[model samples]
Target chain A: MYQNPRAMPSAFQPVPALAIPQGDREGALLVAYANGDPEAAREIMAALAPRVLAQALRMLADRAEAEDVTQDAFLRLWRIAPEWRQGEAKVSTWLHRVTANLCTDRLRRRRRSVGLDEVAEPEDPAPSVAARMQGEARLRALSDALAQLPERQAQAVSLRHLEGLSNPEIAAVMEIGVEAVESLTARGKRALAALLRGRKAELGYDED
Target chain B: MTRIETGADGGRELDDLLAEARALEVVPSAALWARLAADAERERPRPRTVVPAVPPAPGGWRGWLRLLGGWPAVGGFVAATLAGIWIGAAPPTGVSSVLPSLWGEDVSVALGVDEDPLSLLEG
Candidate 1:
């Protein structure tokens, strides 16, 4: 199904919700992988790699680095399968945490390489062609705004909203209290709204 | 002021952004899963017994034997061998009595005893 931009703002276009799979099935698959089932490993990879890649892409804004993050995420996953505890934490939560840490470490390295004392979004960062398509401008703006948020808040918002994880799941992933998760997301959303307020027309909202 | 309504609209706009984010789908390359499978193949050698839940076919030649009549055939062969050995060593009570020549000698001759033990032997 295609959307005519004239018919409705892409923002208002109804979107089918992301299926947040039960962490238990994922947990069971991990157990299967731990027990050396290659099929199970394949299943886990298929199920999780896209989400890992998505989170990485949003965080790093570099395809090569995001791919690397995804690969590393899975490599670590392969190594940890044997020691994985099934019910203690959701598999997706653990994966998001792993990918986030990887992204943060890479970002830190980039900051150090640039000799900047503070980690900052690179100035005039060029979005890839695929990132700049018509409907995706909003995503790019949101991503840019996300990049500007304090790193923790950015990550919190990314996990909570972009990654479709619930507050409790994010709390488990971020290793923070649910109330803290609530605070971070609230602050992050408010900051995002303020940042993008001026660009509404350019970003193609308010046509209605 | 219109600012309050703007803020409310902005929040709705933010909600819309989140929905769009959810709509953003990224699929990993097929090669990624292949690489993981290769790694899993390599690293799967944990010391735990990996027996399938369905219980894999018994493994080597034992599996073959299982496929072909398992213990019953082997047990029958063993029983037959034991019976043959017992017969060669010492047959059952009636087994030898019917044919004394089968032993190749008169066992009574060894003791110099007549067929009727009640008769006194002539010197």
Candidate 2:
């Protein structure tokens, strides 16, 4: 069920769908959690928290705020577990959407009080200091560029390119139609490209 | 160095940046994981259908017997039931004599049932 990335019509192809088969497992674990199976709590965290945290971090570019969003998203999931209609929506997809929305809200609030320059670089604990600095710079540049796009566009693009979700999965996360997702991602990529055009060389991308 | 002048060039650069961003791993801290697990536990629904670790109370006669306060109560009930059945099956001499006294003559004769107009309607 994996579509070749190159064949995708969008300029920025989504990462392959190789790890997309966990939806069923996630749903089952959620049901188990709702049924009061204690171990399922840890299983749910293991299965989802990292990806959710990563998405939030990418969106907010602030570790602490991203953690808060991840926490809030999980709390919402926990509250909705008993009522969650299985097979209707994937748990991870729902979580991604919640996480994205939470990040968007925080972003809006942050925009009012703080400039994009104040958005700190997401911390990464790489072993090499130089490499870590370089990585942080690139990440910060990408995050700032993403911050410039509209919330939905940034979310769609991030889910498509950075998070590696398929177009349908992105649609599910965004609660929109597949065509809308495609359009958002296409337009998002164009906008992102334009935003990052001047910073390419500084970020180490040059004519090859 | 050629600058990104066309959409294709920018797209290529954007792809590289996205790839790098994707490669930048974002593992959750142990504290965050623990916090989420706590949230899960806090919000998890209590089991709706709890099967008793001990077997369920017996139904039917056993339940009825329990409700009646054990074998002693049941013994008294059984005794009373048998006594009533025996009395119905075979009346005592006193009971039989009393029944003739009450039924052989019209009780209206003693109680003046015939005097009452309502008694005529009843008859």
Candidate 3:
């Protein structure tokens, strides 16, 4: 199992060795994969699959759907390899764009399958008294707040804050201008803050 | 007291909320990764060497045409048609080019002109 360097609790951790190289990594992998190197394709997939899945889950709010979308995205990457232009954009950003487009398609199909009103909320587990008295309430509050956002706003917020992508990067992934990404994230944050404010007492958070 | 000060406080609160949200752990299951890898592998292209076309029977006109034309002939036809349309639609130049003179001496009866139009052209 690969350990995530970002998951470490320490303030300082050595950067991951498998972290993608800046200059030639995207071009080399794309060229090799296009030339029918399965190993090169697998390496790129391994590095990117986790974050892509995470982004899908945040968008779809369903583990099964997220897995399907991630698979579809990678499958598209394989098919599109021959047409890839070197240095047009970062490979990671291109994959993110593919994943987002897949998620959008999935959302559209889901809307047809089940009406928005009938879309089920994930069942919340009962919190123990001790857990509720601690940080669990805050976590639950935050999750609920996130669930309330409109789809694009939630996606922009998750990509920017949770995934740590810059505005330009998020714009590339979302297929929009940087200014639009900034607007979506800003509005998402404001809405989240408003939603969480009334539940501060329940969350056991100190007043500002 | 000022609009900028109020906006700064809002921004700080937003940052705090976002930081809290980011702390939540949400890793996808291992089985999901396995499925993705399998799908990617299935979609990977198989490389094949390009093979030369087999020659047709010695007496056929089809074989002769194929040898002469190939893809280049088809490409040339498309290029010529596009070029012809592009040139045909371009605007005509100079006033006289579009409106030809019908007032020449032999052509004067056609327009019922009494004298040469060039005589009127001497301003």
Candidate 4:
């Protein structure tokens, strides 16, 4: 018999992982596009758009602008497909770098007009309505905590933690030394924990 | 609920919190994909034109020779002129008959050897 130490209660089941396709598909499409196939470019853009947009949304905190940044990133990818050298870096990472740069620029431009408190919480009102409701408060608290960090710290934390990139990979994307990346993420995590500690109840961390 | 000691220390708690936060998923709108596709299509560089091959000239051999020699017609003219000049040059008389008497006259002028250079070739 299996010893289930942390079995989910009847009221609470774990959510399944999101099905994001592998990067190989996008790489193939990019190669096809380089070989003068426009349809391949379209396919790659369609596949990558969502992930790029999500990262942008997390970084910029404005859905509309995130969408714009995502589009711009894909556009650059399409234009550069012909010049793309294989085995240099993953296409996804390149796209991430482009999105990050655009978000950074947008953040700089909006610094005067917007405050960190104004970043709207990300929402998805599907699946179990109860889960959706539970996610809102946690998301808001986390977003606020994320907003409070310095720009580089926020970016390092976002790329490493949220985006699930390795520290070295993040360092490459951020064009920084790995040691600097570690320092940023370490500091960013400390700041995040302090920010989120008060809201532990809402985030399901303090539940019995 | 049994609280298992993960031994992650205080930093572990923060890591766990960050992990949970990262697990939150937000799928981008379908419209965003459509817009991205459109933008990609627009930004994609047009395929470069495949240049058609230039057909070799009507006289293939002549064309090849012309290409090989850079200036085929000029090369041909110079070659023909050299050939004509070589053909017009007079052939030499028999070496023995021409050079033996010349050698005898040179010996009489100076105390040279009696046997001529051309006479050495005779049997």
- Best by DockQ, which number? 2
Every prediction's TM-score for the first chain? 0.67, 0.76, 0.64, 0.66
Q: Per-residue alpha-carbon lDDT of model 3 for A62-82, expressed as tens digits?
A: 667778888788787778888
**What TM-score quantifies how close candidate 3 is to the native fold?**
0.55
Off by over 4 Å in 2: A1-23, A117-130, A201-208, B1-9, B48-123
Q: Which of the two candidates, 2 or 4, achieves a greater DockQ against the reference?
A: 2
Residue-by-residue lDDT tens digits, candidate 4, A1-208: 2112133132221221122236555665676666666656555554566688778776654568888888788778877877887667778888888887787677666765656456444366665875755655555456556666787887887787777788888888888999998899788777777766655555656644
**Pairing residues by index, what is the TM-score of model 1?**
0.56
lDDT of 1 by residue, B35-107 (tens): 6556766876343545666445687999877766678987887899999999879988787876666656554
Candidate 2 has what TM-score? 0.64
Residue A52, model 1: lDDT of 91
Best first by lDDT, ranked? 2, 1, 4, 3
TM-score of chain B only, all predictions?
A: 0.28, 0.34, 0.28, 0.30
What's the distance in Å from true for residue A66, model 2?
Answer: 2.3
Candidate 4 ranges with C-alpha deviation above 4 Å: A1-28, A60-62, A107-111, A116-134, A197-208, B1-17, B50-123
Q: Candidate 4 on B1-123: residue-level lDDT in tens? A: 112222233255456655555565556666765676567656656566767576555567777765565576778878998876765574246644676677754433536755577886788
State every prediction's TM-score relative to the real structure. 0.56, 0.64, 0.55, 0.56
DockQ of 2: 0.30
Interface RMSD of each: 7.9, 8.3, 6.5, 9.1
Q: What pairs collide in candidate 1?
A: none
Worst 10-residue lDDT window, candidate 3 chain A = A8-17
lDDT of 3 at A79: 81
lDDT by residue for model 1 (A81-137), tens? 878887888788889999988877776666545432232323343566434553455
